[model samples]
Target: MRELFTDLDIFNAIGIVGVSLYIANYTALQTGFVRGQGYVYPTVCLIAASCVLASLMQDFNLSSAVIQVTWITISIIGITRMYVLGVTSRFSDQERLFIRHMANGLPEHRARALLDNGMWLTADPGTVLTHEGEPVDHLSFVASGKAKVIVADKTIATSGAGMAIGEITYLSGEPATATVEVAEKMHLIRFEADKLRAFVQRNPDIGAVLEQNMANHLRSKLVSMSETASRAPVPASADAAAA
Candidate 1:
């Protein structure tokens, strides 16, 4: 068998690694594995550029050096912009609370996109948020006040702050699972289904964060329901039979 390499210098190895990174990064972007909006892409490009620039010390190429330097400069600019947007982003109190609770890991810019697409509203008491078996037009996050989750006109649960409404139908494109009625006037963050779906399709990272948030909230609700069921008193007839 013939050997592919006998002796590879450190600088050449670094340059090869850089080439690999360049190829891999581009491939990841094309394959939907990495997003162009975030820091990871630019950071990887910066590192790759650095490696290629270092390799130029071993065997200089003016054109290659220029390309690498340009890549490095562009990458640096992109990274700096993303950082600034995340750091200098402004948010209101309800926005801050919503981001902290449901979309904690989102970059401020993306969080802003989400919040901007949604509207903040106050629902008066007796407002019908969702109707049973009807298509839900939007998703709601309760910033304040309370609501009842009703099925067949029976109250099954109370939704308060930090709870997500219509997330299931938002994901499934199904009808509302239950009727939600505002018992007390509610401050709400509402995202229309069409807009949210479009945004999520365009920015999947935000979708991922939202999905995770929904999963966590649903799990907690399940746990609370389980506890409530467990605490229910035994029936009198059952208790008498046990005695």
Candidate 2:
């Protein structure tokens, strides 16, 4: 085993596999490639293993050409898996709706701006959409499913489809006050915070849309909280009735 790994060719092959695996893993993990799907993790493992195999077998006698073929096959599989994940992921439906909804409210130029920044991807449960106290990098728009907004200890508000998130951080230019987590599989579109600021500075119309969306989101949350409060019993009133 030591000799096998010590050879320069083998080492280089291993290096190739290692770097490729890192790229693949980052792409999947950062971009929410495996949300709510069993195949994503398994596929990642398979690709990593294949890369190792390709590295180890390339120098063997009596089938060097065959080893190359296997390497190509593994790479092809990896690419295909990424495509499948993208096409069939949670974002498909929500992305369409996101485009349509934003289209109604935004002109073509603003719509293009949204994509030019960052865009939609699906995330799994337990994924931290954004962390409290982290520098705001991007603004995320929830396209589908739910996210938990942690306001205080044991106090959380769930934001669902069509809600805009991360704007508070963007507007305040401060670290997030609370963390956002994916409560379930969620599809989301995002815009780079810096790019958005620049765009907003240059184009007042785009800025207006962004501000409007933020207002709308705040209003919705307020309404939801109000309704929840209204449904709760007043302790003093209840005590008087009991007396």
Candidate 3:
């Protein structure tokens, strides 16, 4: 095997290793960055070893050298981005806020009232929390984990701990325009619409808190989407429509 490898061009060998490393780096990034499986590091290391082996060989070419360098450059950037993503995921404000909110929703005294009124906790990543274009039957709170609100095939926001999911539609008694999907394994607390309404009637303060929170969240999300769209480049078709 060693003798057969010796017959290959030195630069080509290095290039192959570099390409492998770059691929591994990007894959690791997609799978939750550094918190991902431990196998990516070992794969990267093996690729680096291959590059060293190639440098020791005799046959080398300009094409091989260029390919090898390109791979190395790409790998370095990919790995750096992976590390940055890991760091950001760990300290994201949105993530932290979700935790805080989940821990501190409507007072504990109100929880039983919700549960007695047909509210129950369910945890499932595969469950369809809400379907777009369908009438919402319940109001859901994120007791734990995260969910994405998808409107017209576009992701509107990721709701984390302490956030409610279906209040808008539940309150308006209208068909839902957005679908809520579990972005991560989530612990959802749900209340039947009729029961929720009864509880609100009895505990007006808690009801007000829930409504205000939902309205504020919607406003914040809209403002954020608008700002992001403003900063993004407009396609020719979109610009023509505006003109």
* Overall lDDT per candidate, in order of appearance: 0.89, 0.67, 0.64
Error of 3 at 214 (Å): 2.8
Worst 10 residues of 3 by lDDT: 95-104
Please estimate how well model 3 matches the true structure, expressed as its whole-model Cα lDDT.
0.64
TM-score for all models, in order of appearance: 0.88, 0.52, 0.47
lDDT digits (tens) for residues 16-121 of candidate 1: 9999999999999888688888898999999999999999998999999999999999999999999999889999888888997779888899889889889999
Q: What lDDT is reached at residue 43 by model 3?
A: 46
Q: Candidate 3: where are CA atoms >4 Å away?
A: 1-122, 231-243
User: Among all windows of ten consecutive residues in candidate 2, which has the lowest summed lDDT?
Assistant: 33-42
The true-versus-predicted C-alpha distance at residue 141 of model 3, in Å, is: 1.4
Relative to the unseen true structure, what is the C-alpha lDDT of residue 191 in candidate 1, on a scale of 0 to 100? 92
Clashing residue pairs in candidate 1 (N, C-alpha, C atoms within 3 angstroms): none
**Which residue ranges in model 1 land beyond 4 Å of their true spot?**
1-7, 27-34, 233-243
Who wins the TM-score comparison? 1
Residue-level lDDT tens digits of model 2 in 185-230:
9888888888888977776555666677676666777799678768
Give per-residue CA lDDT, model 3, range 1-243, as digits (tens). 998788767566665766676577667656635322233564474466457446645555667556655655655666666555444544235334432443235433343333455444656675678899999988776767888878889886677776777777876888887898888888766778877788777776456556666677667666876786677777999999999
What ranking emerges by lDDT with the best candidate at the front? 1, 2, 3
Indicate which candidate wins on lDDT. 1
